[model samples]
Target: MLTYCLNEYPSAHGFENGLRPQLTFICKAEGNEAAIPRVMHKHDERFELMFILAGTGIYNIDGRGYNVKRGDLLLFNAGVLHDENPHTSDDLLIFSCGVEQLKFEGLPLNYLTTRSQAAVMPSGHLYGEIRGIFEQIWQQVMSKKRYGAEIAHHLLSVLLLLCRNIWLENNPEYSSADSLLGQKIKTYIDNHYKDEIALKSITAALNMNQFYLAHVFKAWSGYSPKQYQTRRRIGEAQSLLLSTDLGVTEVANAVGYDNVNNFHRIFHNLVGIPPARYKKFWLTGHIKS
Candidate 1:
């Protein structure tokens, strides 16, 4: 996985020039896959969209499958499980790009994130046009010429906006709140999980039965409300660890963990390592991910 960077682009989240989370610039790209692989099971933190530049495959996203061919696009929202296997004995080439972390700005956040299937963007002629834009951006990133980063940033913006338009056009009935009640619960948790969140408080706030809330929330997202909240907290914690110099206890507290020990246990449980070690993994240049 490669993480692209543009230090002089406009940021969507008040990140000044040359910062992360700009209106979602390309954080990574996988250009050519001349050497074929039959099967791939992958997941990532970023919102990933893959344009099938060539070949055909059965693409699976979050358990739902779609038969995809050249000129098709497959979307895997941040952290969604996806797999691909081609029926033909040919190389499956793809141009995959991602945003390291999601901060909704120009794109429709809820619609993109809660997608249950690998969306198919079918436009054969338009595929060539989109690929041209990608090629220009790829050259800019690779060349690193004067204003290369800024130029690439603009090109990336165009690419994403075009893609978003295509995605929305392809699915006219796409709803940001696919599951209205469940989405509301998710939004509340995403915003308030940084503080104490009681399940009963959520139920009372929503004026719904606990069992019904659990059923819907679980159905919408695989996890129950509490589980989702914890996962969100941990996800925030990971972001903080990567982006800040705060200590483990402070990071834990920042993400709503009152007990440092419990936070440590949960972080380790969800992530394979402790907080300190996780940070070290980034610091040590072990991976560009």
Candidate 2:
């Protein structure tokens, strides 16, 4: 077989809006009991792409639950809070990569797609191809050979382009007005989750009536304002537990729960496990069924 010259192949267009992706990290959890359940968390400056290599699981993304299985690719856009707590008996295995400085045309910085799009998409016919690409990137990064970073960077660009193509294929549609209002409500909650704010006061501050505010918000997002606030509080608590060495009571207080017992009850209700045990499983990497 003769080697073909670059001019012999078809021409290709470059990325739109000068998009350049920087790979921050690659994480793989396979056949490990400690890897099933990850505490809820968010990345302000990076987006994450995770592929379920084997097993079925449920992931909480942006205050919603998504059932995922093999051949599923999950996208966690920048600033989108998410968590994973698979069943104890399932053999869940996943490979994840974090990308920074990514922005498609008309999208926010570090965001792969709009918030309205579904975060989990079936890889379909591309599953094997995409999985191979991820494995190549992982191998390149782990080898530490010459030009490893450069190779991995190019591979990451390929992965992102594929993801964008798939997202485009999905053809997600949502009203801009509703998305904006939902964002405003979410922003208010994010800024004031520490406070004991009520729906009436939230509506007053936003200058909208309770009924309209509630309707629009619930329509735009699956959760009500109250439910969203509670999840936000618990998500922060999860982060604090994994990142800090503070006691459960201190974590509760930090997340705005004055009563320690109340904190435990709410945390258990939302997380399906006690706060202290959540931290322990994360640390030990094994869940005690």
Candidate 3:
């Protein structure tokens, strides 16, 4: 047998001493027959990593859609908006965890990657290793045994390092000046999606011609400005429905809909189900649709 010693190989790159990640929660979802959406939202103080254990879906991250499949890992850095649109195939399984107080050297708070990097990456050859790590974490969390949190903490560090290595190997090269304007528009909308704003307001705030802004934004995001804002509002409405005890009208108004009828129409059109039934399906595991 051959053995290797760590002291024999000094690495030039290593994790910073200040790096400490706190695991907030770990969850696994499977066997959902309906492709219910987890709408556009972001965590301001934590990072979320998800492994698609099976099935395929579309994840909209930072205004673009990624077609993700099994063995794919998705990273949602803090304050980055994302929407989950699962396909209605009934075999989707996902393992996800949330981490707080995470900061990498030279990176923003809770960010594992730069803005240029794609949020979704295929595990490829590392599929087994990555999946095993998630499974271990899930077991620790579910068992609630002694030293479980400590064990999961160490495992999280290893998982993060593996993700960083994968990112380095991928060497993302997607950012450019052309995308900046589109991103700016998205940021503005994200900040004010609940407000009664218009295309003219966006153009005036960003100081771009109305026509030019529309053209560039459509080209970059595959949705017109109005379309993007509508989706954003509807997405938040969906979030409030399932996650909170707010009533339907209250939910509608909270998401910027003054008229509940209009809200119902729009929500039904986009989500393929009304708000009340959507919440009922999630709560009761039965959908009339």
TM-score, predicted candidate 2 vs. hidden true structure: 0.77
Candidate 1: tens digits of C-alpha lDDT, residues 6-42: 8666544321233333224343323232322212233
Best by TM-score: 3
Ranking by TM-score: 3, 2, 1
Which regions in candidate 3 have their CA more than 4 angstroms from the true location?
10-15, 195-215, 242-245, 280-289
Model 2: per-residue Cα lDDT over 1-289, one tens digit each: 8898999876654365676789999988876463435545699989999998887776867644577888999999898887676554446678999999887777888887787777889999999889999999999999999999899999999998998888888758554887778878888987898899899989999999999998888776567888778878888998898889999999999999999999999888877779988888877866665
Q: Tell me which residue pairs clash in candidate 2.
A: 34-285
Cα lDDT tens digits, model 3, 50-115, are 999898887878876688899999999998888887776668788889998777777888899887
Candidate 1's C-alpha runs over 4 A off are 1-25, 29-136, 146-154, 174-178, 287-289
Q: How many steric overlaps are in each model, in order?
A: 2, 1, 0
TM-score, model 3 to reference = 0.86
Candidate 3 or 2, higher lDDT: 3
The better candidate by lDDT, 1 or 3, is 3
Give the winner by TM-score: 2 or 3: 3
lDDT of 1 at 226: 85
Compared with the true structure, model 1 gives a TM-score of 0.56
Model 2 residue 49 CA deviation (Å) reads: 0.9
- lDDT for 29 in candidate 3 is 80
Off by over 4 Å in 2: 1-20, 30-40, 54-69, 83-89, 103-108, 142-150, 176-181, 206-220, 287-289
